[model samples]
Target: MMKKTNYSYIGIAFIILVFGILFVPKIVDRISNNDITRKESRSDQKLKNKALKQSDLVFIENTNNGENRRVPAFSFVNQYGKQVTNKDYEGKVYVIEFFFTTCPTICPRMNNNLVQIQNTFEDFEDFGVASFTINPEYDTQEVLKNYASTYDITNPNWHLLTGDKAAIYKLANEGFYIYAAENSAIEGGFEHSGNFALIDKNGFIRSRKDAFGNPIIYYRGITSEEEGTDDNGEVEQISILKEDIKKLLNE
Candidate 1:
């Protein structure tokens, strides 16, 4: 009777071991699959957040051009006698401004404001500053070089560009969407917006602070009201611009 009872106990133990062998791996696999799904869900959420940050930036859109908007192709000569086109700034972040060296009204302040930004990011190689001359006739490369000296601009990263009026105007008005016209009444003999434009590395004009304020919500770019003043309104512009640049860089 003792030997029979011992055999019965061994039989029960063997059955329990066989059941664990059959079921344990499947249970572990199910747990591993759930963990993989959880990890994938977390990755997707991070990507979604990153995309939101990129799209939150202001975009200059032309419904006529469909949903995708970009800066038109352009070619010009920089102050250093180098041919500057969209290629020069490809894969890099940059700021573009429309101004002539002869302006006695707003260009001074614009230059000064730009100087501060330049100084701030002077060491950043992936960044650049390009100022286009509305009066290309007077702002030849040599002349631009001379004017740039006034603001102590010594870095080649800060390019002053000049080119044919028709191309420049098309780019300014249609590409960058800033107003550039021959106006005899304006102090500089030309009428152009003082708004500085921010361009992403992908050749898209990300933001324009101009008269239209096209979207009317973005405060990072120049505004019609802010451009008219001589005070520190641009201080706010500088702050926003810096923040936006850092935002883009991080992404």
Candidate 2:
């Protein structure tokens, strides 16, 4: 009986030890997974809040220009035979994009997305969209008018602008911090990229974003380009660009 009791005690001890070894690992794994999940949740929340934090600043400093200059003004025309200057649209929301009617690729997709923007803000009288033709010489008012018609872009708030090549190039380089180089072979105008310059009601350039990703500002045009091998690339991507625009509009 003594020996049997001793054996029984030994068996109980072994069982307890095995159970503890198995249970501890699962407990530890559960803690580690929970910690990781918590961290990720916090990170996502931070990005959400950052996107919501808009700015009231009128102007943002740009470094793309050779002189690291601020955009002061631009002189261009709308398709309706009206002259437009940067000063004309003070305290109104607008967007400016670069393109020619003859772009063989990318521009079409960008414009299709832009149409969604045009329709979205058509009712907002204070908002407008402007597209400037890099090939101003060929993109006559008539050409722009026809193009606008094809897209059903009849919003009075929208403007398809064309002007002298020299002035447009200057505006592209100096005013908007965009590069519109004159390439002989490309049809509609110059070799330009796809970018959108977002300006606020205060005549200040607040944000520059891509043609497709951002919300359209019923006031301007859009542009696109392939800078490098298309692997997670962001060319002239403005930091806090969207937030800055929102801030200006809200203010």
Candidate 3:
């Protein structure tokens, strides 16, 4: 009777050992995966906070935070010949770029990249692109429409706006902090910064450093060499612009 009791105890211990060997690895795997997810979440939060801290951007006081920049007022006409103004963009996030309809180099590259941006964020109703024509006389509403058609741009949210030369130039220089000048020597007879800005719904420009390391809320345009690279390896300034927009949207 004592020997039979001892054998029973040994049998029970062997069963428990086999069970642990089969299920322990699965439980451990689940725990490891959970830890990785938590780490990724923390990393994302850190990046968002870092971007918000850059002094290059202006901010507005709000219920959540007391810092943001306010965009100045403006009146312009879109490609469809409809008037566009500040009220139209009251609750929208958009990027503004200066480009001419006809250009030999940079403008074409810039505009093409913008098309990609438009497609990438097409599903976002609150976001859009604003391509302002520096050559107002040549890039009239009709000309802009023609240009839009060639690019197969059917999205009305992407506005190609035109207004008084002085007013437009004022916005470009003082408001957008970009360089735009009438240079006959340039291929397009006009020259402007290759950069574009990501504006929040409240119109605060996103922050990035300028060439001089000044606090600027604009991304420099694709130029002669070495800069932002996208996932597919096509070099363009739009990649940086795209990432910045995503970060703002997530916030």
Candidate models: Cα lDDT each: 0.76, 0.66, 0.76
Ranking by TM-score, best first?
A: 1, 3, 2
Per-candidate clashes come to: 1, 22, 7
Output the lDDT of residue 84, model 2.
76
Q: Candidate 1 lDDT, tens digit per residue, 154-179? A: 66678999999889999888776677
Query: Residue 229 lDDT in model 1?
Result: 38
RMSD of 3: 12.5
Per-residue error for 129 in candidate 1, Å, reads: 1.5
Error of 1 at 99 (Å): 0.7
Writing each residue's lDDT as its tens digit, candidate 3 over 1-251 gives 99999999999999999988999887788678887778888999999897875433434333345555456688899989999987687677788888888877688767777777788888888778888898898889999999999987766678999989999999888776778889998676888888877787667776655568655556655531234564467465556677777666655
Off by over 4 Å in 3: 1-68, 208-216, 223-236
